[model samples]
Target: MTLLKTPLLDTIREPADVRRLPQEKLAQLAAELRAETIDAVSVTGGHLGAGLGVVELTVALHHVFNTPHDRLIWDVGHQCYPHKILTGRRERIRTLRTGGGLSGFTNRAESEYDPFGAGHSSTSISAGLGMAVARDLGGGERNVVAVIGDGAMSAGMAYEAMNNAGAMDSRLIVILNDNDMSIAPPTGAMSAYLARLISGQTYRSLREIGKQIAGHLPKFVERGAQRAEEFARGFWTGGTLFEELGFYYVGPIDGHNLDHLLPVLKNVRDAKTGPILVHVVTQKGKGYGPAEQSADKYHGVVKFDVVTGAQVKAKSNAPSYTRVFAESLISEARRDPKIVAITAAMPSGTGIDLFGQAYPDRTFDVGIAEQHAVTFAGGLAAEGFKPFCALYSTFLQRAYDQVIHDVALQGLPVRFIVDRAGLVGADGATHAGAYDLAYLGCLPGMVLMSPADEAELMHMIATAVAYDDGPSAVRFPRGEGVGVERPDRAEALPIGKGRMVRGTGEGDVAILSLGTRLAAALEAAERLEAAGFAVTVADARFAKPIDRDLALKLASGHSALVTVEEGSIGGFGSQVLQFLTDEGVLDRGTVKVRSMVLPDIYIDHDTQARQIAEAGLDANAIVAKVEGLLGKAKAGRELSRAG
Candidate 1:
């Protein structure tokens, strides 16, 4: 337990406790909260930099606002650790991101303090706007505040909410917590803040008077005045961009200083405004030395040394899939001049940063905007550039409309390199890439492939690069490869083809494994062989296109056909089932067919092995399914004999 006994932190259990404390004591509370956040994250290994950055802001917001009644939404929820500790979750703070414990991100189900759930970026404004709208309808005076990050502002959704809120004239409070970076360094004007503009009372009064003057002026005069204000603001706060979007822009204030945060928050709470945007600039890792120095690396950490600030990572024998993708993409980019890489804020996570190192001009990081990233890649693809749109499986869901309308329907030859395509350990259901296969595979003319390991992923990368007919995708799971030997040069694997890994000329039972589940399929086949059942294993490289010849042969030859995939119900298993049905494979009735896919319900955070087993796609689960099916067949034969 990372529990600390600070005079200030110890007294607080809720927002009411925060309110009860004297305003002078808020600074001490923030310091204690920061220490507690670092200590707790050191043991549990969560989002340390973000929560550390917002320590003062969190205290101020909770203290000033009547929370649970008033809504406080933390965008992306990476900074909610301190918020959670102060809001009745301090005892379970260390249990964050573990199985049956508190979620790393803010979950509404977990606590009333969490008015809206957040995991993906840029959704807080939209959710908070809805809450504010609901409050208006319900005739409630409860405050609705959405604390967003500069990173989240990159997404159009945040702006859309702002636009709507501005037009509707909703009393919404938006705290733009600019840590000066998202995953990588901040891009665009989102990180720009006013230089000492909101530090003094004179400027605040002038800005308020200026807003009143601008509103009363004629349309033409207002435009002229707005331009002049923009020029003045460029020097003062650089918040004209937010102002143009219909938000009352305030600050470029020091987020670390409680003296600054407390009064601004109090003013915002008291002011009758339509969607106010308070620009608070804070360091990502404020108090902690190591985190402050190397913010990105410390953003998400494993259990680490609190004293030295060294992360305690387990030794791995294999290079991670992320690194392998980066290396392979870099190699591909060297040979092809047209090849371009794009990621939605996740430069290092997708390993696109390594590709950027090789070809800086060729790599584009769109920042928290998956929608723009997808369409931007589509535009490049339209221009005959080989744009590899790399995104994590879960994050890509945010841009699925672009994936369908812009890329797939238009038939742009965009290469989608879907990372974290299976159960991502620790990140849990919100971050799982379980639905990519189902969603992407269903698209017409979309070619979907899942690599069994790192070596195969290299080949898939090459395949995606060469394919120009339509949208093509390659999905690979999170973490390291299965220690396969790396090839000096990559070759494109044949489209719509599957390869047999085991069995002789024939076998009674056929196992068609997809994605990273091949290793477990082989393990299950070994178990089946020992039990006197001849088993064959085949790796279905392409989820789309189906590998008809191979699937038909397996079905016609084997007594039993089983499909295994690390995806949801509508993905690889569904594809196999639909294809077999269309081909009349099941009409024969002799082959007992089974499709193993992740269930319809969302599974919580657990070890990858445990998650797969729970999904019944693991080796032991597969073996059990096979034995049960065989046992049923034997009983049927015995009943026939008796009859």
Candidate 2:
């Protein structure tokens, strides 16, 4: 592949170099930066469309603001690829999202330029506000700027921050990157003129003078005067919402135009306003032909051909866990008219898009607001609807309070279809769904099921649909299922029941597995059997309402019992251990018990296989764990014989 010419981008090592360049040359620099961002993402396969959209904005921000000291915060950080390239990281840009390389999102540890690390959306304004307040308390003169996407504005947190920032006197600047859809038409010379005039020092001084004049008037008159001023400005600019929230609003400016972005950013940067919001509009995939044509495909991509824009996707023999869940749910919804699906701005990611295609009225995309999605489903469940709230396990953490207060406490039959339940590759620790089992298992009257395969996933979906007594969740991992023929008709399993997958006879050692780690346990059992030790393998099925009878049977029947799960420490293994202790199974000292779970440390971005191996949840790790346990058991036996 021929490298795109980035002549101007090659000369720049940092934002300081960007500042040194003349304004006329800055446009050329932005073009080079755009080309470089596309080329790098095409090679590395990270977030492309967002970064592409922000190329000029990034150049303008770096050029206008004294970054590193100024504290420029990118809201979601997927769009920070352009920012990353300009912030002395261009040399290593190709290593993005790879193991032991640059992160796909902004990471504070990776660079001082990244004041706050972000993988999730709708956090920049809050973080930037905190920084602004701190800077004021410290008597620092450094500016604080937050650039947030329009989609991120859907979350309540963004508005909460704005409300607080609006009420305060702390100097902060917020740039609303409205790329997906337009709030207003930002065109012609007149719009640019209005943006410049509104943000200009002269306009700000006159506005402050008017506020002073209003303060002297009667309360009613002051209120009327404020309304009139806001009405006049908002009539032209559509900033009344922001003005009411206590921010000096500007723009609906062209984000792609460096000429437009630079002057406005510089105005806000120097303005004495308490909090200012500049609305800048741009296209998601602005430059590259394929990306510009179909922004969604390039939003997140695999390593793609720079010329042809074709992504390199691996061939899969079986359907993905996400696809299987969607298909099963669609099948179930066909039979059940009350069934509904909800997703928090992740229709495609959670396979809710397919469900929507089948039943559009039954599907809801809540738009980057996980908390709202949870409660919305609760309301649906209250109205006799079987609402399946499909969310990534990691994203569900944002709505824990609603999960407890709204759903679980009220005994709402909200079926949580948790996708991405284990170590997610490329996205790293921020996106890892390692804590769902731990968080949800402790909730009373909650039914939690982890499927061992795609077929089991189908059964679990049916189980969740039938479980109308309380809140229930099914968590599956982020990749292709192990090839297993799915059942023709989905059958709901008995609640809290487990099935022994192998070794019917009472073996010397038993491996109790949960979630998708059953395949590893089975493989480990084979290795143990070949080594002249009998091994039994069973799938716990449910993390909560854990298979109590199976737990006792395994504890008493085996000399050594090793519990394995693809979750953190306080999950399935912990549940079993608690049950055994409570039941006097551990008091007898007849069997040695061990638990295998994900490691305490956060694993970096890598292949899912590599990450699971590192977490010691793989077949080899399970075999090693069993071998170690049996060694201790044999030693105890020998000591008893001598005694």
Per-residue lDDT of 1-643 in model 2, one digit per residue for the tens?
2177878888888999999999999989988888888888888898999999999999999999998999999998889998988998888899998888899989999999999999999999999999999999999999999999999999999999999999999999999999986887696578888898899999989988999999999999999998898899999989899988999899889988887778888888888769999999999988999999998888999999888999999899999999999999999999999999999999999999999999999999989999999999999999999999999999999999999999999999999999999899999999999999999999999999999999999999999999999999999999999999988988999999999999973878999999899999989888778777778899999998999999898889999999988888899899999989999889999999999988998888888998999999899998888878776344456568899
Error of 1 at 559 (Å): 1.7
How high is each candidate's TM-score? 0.93, 0.97
Write candidate 1's Cα lDDT for 1-643 as tens digits: 4446787788787889999999889888889999999998888898999889999899989888998888899998989999999999999988888878889999878999998888898999899899889988988888999999988888899989888988887789999888874222322243322323342355668867987888898988978987786787655566677777888777777777776677677777876667888888789899999999999998999999999999999899999999999999889888999999999899999999999989999999988889899999999999999999999999999999999999999999999989999898778888999999999999999999998988999999999999999999999999999999989999998889999999962677899999889999999998778766778899999999889888888888888888999988899878888988987888979688899888888888777877777788889888888877776344455568899
lDDT of 1 at 122: 90
Candidate 1 segments exceeding 4 Å error: 3-5, 181-235, 632-643
Give the range where candidate 2 is weakest over 10 consecutive residues by summed lDDT. 630-639
